[model samples]
Target: MASADSLSKLLRCPETRQELRPLDDSKLDELNEAIRAGELHNHAGDEVEQTLDAGLIREDDAVVYPIRDGVPNLLIDDRIPLKDSD
Candidate 1:
């Protein structure tokens, strides 16, 4: 359950080698469960990737984002911010 700030810095695409800046963690839990229950699909619907890549959606208008590795980077920068705001 990594925070959004941490996830942002660690998130990266394996194919295009691009960095992903998705926005909700609490909501992300639903996605993770959906992926597990087969309710939702992956980048290639109906087919899931082995990696933690998962997927992303705006999730309402509150900025609920996703994460990778074991942490979530919510910061709006390339490097992890030392201080995060609530």
Candidate 2:
């Protein structure tokens, strides 16, 4: 299980290019499962209602993050295009 602090270091905004804080521990776990399961682009828990980082909450011994505004955008869009080594 990855720590929220490590996950926080892993996360970054797509458009803003800013570091993202773990929504919560529970949300972090949910995010881990979701990412491994291909649920969303990346693990970005409910940011609509809950704080960017909230208290830990457990469910079924699993973390469940609230879906905010029906979307989770955690991917960083690299502006620099890949250069072909032709």
Candidate 3:
């Protein structure tokens, strides 16, 4: 997992170009649960099948970038689009 300070300095939303913050624990857990259930999807409609070890949420909360093995996967096509209810 990437440290909050490092991630804040290095990550941004690929689509929105918004700054990213480390996802809070509760939100991370919720997202992980959704991923585990195969319920998470990206903006391009691709299913997210991998468990999220860490994540960064866009400043506007519109998307989440998964951090795997301490690296932020900021690819536009891999970003998880956040719904109003998520």
Candidate 4:
């Protein structure tokens, strides 16, 4: 995975065209846990069934683009939208 500093400098959200920041460790861990528990979802309201190794959350916290194998999957369809936890 790219270092947080590097990601912050280089990555942007594919959907909103806004800058992205690497999720902090605690937040990353929480998201990963949710992924493992089958709790993650996308904007389309579909469940995210894959593991997120790491991610860059949008500055507005609206969505997260997953990073797999050190590559940020910034495709719009790949974005995981942030949702209120029930």
Candidate 5:
């Protein structure tokens, strides 16, 4: 299995095909907060119940794919949309 750093270099958004990189720690904290608050949902419209162990974010920061057990779940329907901030 490839290391997360190497995998990130090869990963792309399944829908937009944008380059993906490991989501930064600060952003991960924010994501966890929303998840704990029962406020985040995936593209499939299901509430994201599990706190992400890690994640990959697209270049534009529009969405994130959760990484579980060192494997990225690249399914389009599993992608979580990000809220825009002013």
Candidate 6:
């Protein structure tokens, strides 16, 4: 996997065109907790079935795109909204 710094330089939100940064560990943990508990769903309304290895959070911190096995899932329907969470 590319280091966060490298990924940050290359990735952007497909919808917003905003720069993205790695999701911090604390937030990743919280996200996984929600995923494990079946409490989170993607914008597509499908339950997210796998825990993320990493995530890219948008510059404004409004959403995150999941990275699994070193590949980013940037599909619009797969972006998880951060503003709606606790």
The residue pairs in collision within model 5 are none
* Candidate 5 lDDT: 0.88
Q: C-alpha displacement of 82 in model 4, angstroms?
A: 1.2
> Tens digit of lDDT per residue, candidate 5, span 1-85?
9975786688888777899988899999999999999999998889999999989998988899999888899999998988553
Q: Candidate 3: which pairs clash?
A: none
Q: List runs of model 1 lying over 4 Å from the truth.
A: 1-22, 49-67, 70-86
**lDDT per residue as tens, model 3, 1-86:** 99668858776666667789888889889998998998988767888888889888889887888889988888878888786643
**Clashes per candidate, residues 3 or more apart or on different chains:** 15, 0, 0, 0, 0, 0
Candidate 1 residue lDDT tens string, 1-86? 99777966665543334455553456455555655765543322233322234333322232222346745434332122112220
Model 1 lDDT on a 0 to 1 scale: 0.40
Model 6: lDDT of residue 61: 89
Q: lDDT for model 4, please.
A: 0.78
Model 4 Cα lDDT, one tens digit per residue, 24-72? 7788788788888988877667788777778888888878888889888
CA lDDT, every prediction?
0.40, 0.37, 0.82, 0.78, 0.88, 0.88
Candidate 4 deviates by what RMSD? 3.7
Find the 10 residues in a row with the least total lDDT in model 6.
Answer: 77-86
Show model 3 residue runs off by greater than 4 Å.
1-7, 84-86
Which runs of model 4 end up more than 4 angstroms from their true locations? Answer: 1-8, 84-86
Cα lDDT tens digits for candidate 6, 1-86: 89767857888888879898889999999999999999888878889889999998999988889999988999989988878651
Estimate candidate 6's alpha-carbon lDDT, on a 0 to 1 scale.
Answer: 0.88
Quote each prediction's TM-score: 0.34, 0.27, 0.82, 0.76, 0.87, 0.87
